[model samples]
Target: MSESLTIVGIAGSLRAQSYNRQLLAAAGELLPNDVRFILADISNVPLYNEDLESALPEAVVTLKQTVESADGVIFATPEYNGSIPGVLKNVIDWLTRPRGQSSLNGKPAGIIGGTTGMFGAVNAQMHLRHILPLLNMYVIPQPLVLISQIQNKLDAAGHLTDETSQKFLQQHLDRLVSVARRMKNEQ
Candidate 1:
């Protein structure tokens, strides 16, 4: 049997009740036995600084190591002003540092997010999709997991209550694992 795939999940929002974080929790619960979903804490990742590249912050170093060792990455972002939030962008910047030596190079990534708005963070997801390739990350192209009107769909415990949404999320995660394995084989 093939070894299990490790997928690191990062939620862009730092809010205690962020819909994005709730969506990540649901995804974690939905992961299959062959796939593991690890939630990464980006709340303490400091702002990017060129000076720190020589001696990266402990948080940055840990973030890079975690992602570099993972088989795939999942970004759960909340849109702010039609784009990704500053905190999430900061994390990305730190990971993309040292240019061609980024940890995301050739790694598979999936985007999932939740928002109160009707569009469900589509704009932010698109922006992220555009950025991941620049860092040499392979992004899953199908089954976009965008949760809209999340307030009505999630339970008090922050779990996805809609059956259809749960099914789709599971499908997307399965696809992510498959793609990640394929990429690993190619490398």
Candidate 2:
């Protein structure tokens, strides 16, 4: 087995009880021993501004450094009107600053999300699938974790109680680990 991989997980919602946040918490429980999952704080990251690029906010700088140092990233997004939330996109914009020299460039990423809607956050994830590549991120292709009706799937402690969700999350993490390792090797 290869060495442990450090993954930074970003939850897109700022709600106190966001399903996406709970989903990421559950993912941490399912991760393998050889993986370390760290949740990035996007709540404090201000809106992206080109004028502030040269003097980025402390939060943005910390977020960028964390992502740049990680072996992989996991985006837990919340859909709004069949699209990704603006805050999530804003964070990505910050990471993509300095144009072709984005911190996310060439990084491996896994997209997952939860919602009460029947289709889950598929629309949001699809948007990210297209967008991450533009920032030069290599996203995992299989085992997409579009957790639908998430309110019933998680417990009071934010643990994913559904068996199917657990299985899919495990599969997604497995692929992320393999892909991250492969990308690191090629780097």
Candidate 3:
């Protein structure tokens, strides 16, 4: 039997009740048996500092290692003031360190999110579309997920209970796995 593909997920929100994190949980439940989703811990990642770039903190090292080990990455972010959240951007900056030796190089990635607003995390995903390519990531093009009205989609335990949302998430996960598998085989 083939080994399960590992996808590292990063939740951009730091809030305990963040809809994006809940969306990630939902995404996790929908993944296929051949795909394993591992959520990256963002709580301990410090603000990006060029001086510390040479000697990354232990948390940052672990984060990089997690991404490096994964077959792909999924970024679930919350749009903040018409842009990506500060913490999310900071994490990306840290991941893109040493000028030209980014950990995301040649990795496949998918972006999705949930938000209270009507547009969900559209702006944030757009920003990532532009930014990720610069870091040498092969991002998926079609079927971007921006889950709006998040409060109505998740249960009290932060699990996605809405059937329609689950279908949507499944579609995205399917695409992520497909693209990630192709990338993995190419290497």
Off by over 4 Å in 3: none
Candidate 2 residue-wise lDDT, 43-148, digit = tens: 8898888998778899998999999999999999989999999999999999988666588988899999989988879999999999998878889998889889
Give me the runs in candidate 2 sitting further than 4 Å from their true place: none
Model 1 over residues 94-124: C-alpha lDDT tens digits? Answer: 9888777688888889998878888889999
TM-score, structure 1 vs. true: 0.95
Q: Candidate 2: minimum summed lDDT over ten consecutive residues — where?
A: 97-106
What are the Cα lDDT values of the candidates? 0.88, 0.90, 0.87
lDDT of 3 by residue, 44-84 (tens): 99999899977889999999999989999999999999889
TM-scores, one per candidate: 0.95, 0.96, 0.95
Clashing pairs in 1: none
Q: What TM-score does candidate 3 get on C-alpha atoms?
A: 0.95
Report clashes for each candidate as comma-separated counts: 0, 0, 0
Weakest ten-residue segment in model 3 by summed lDDT: 161-170
Best by lDDT: 2
Error of 2 at 148 (Å): 0.9
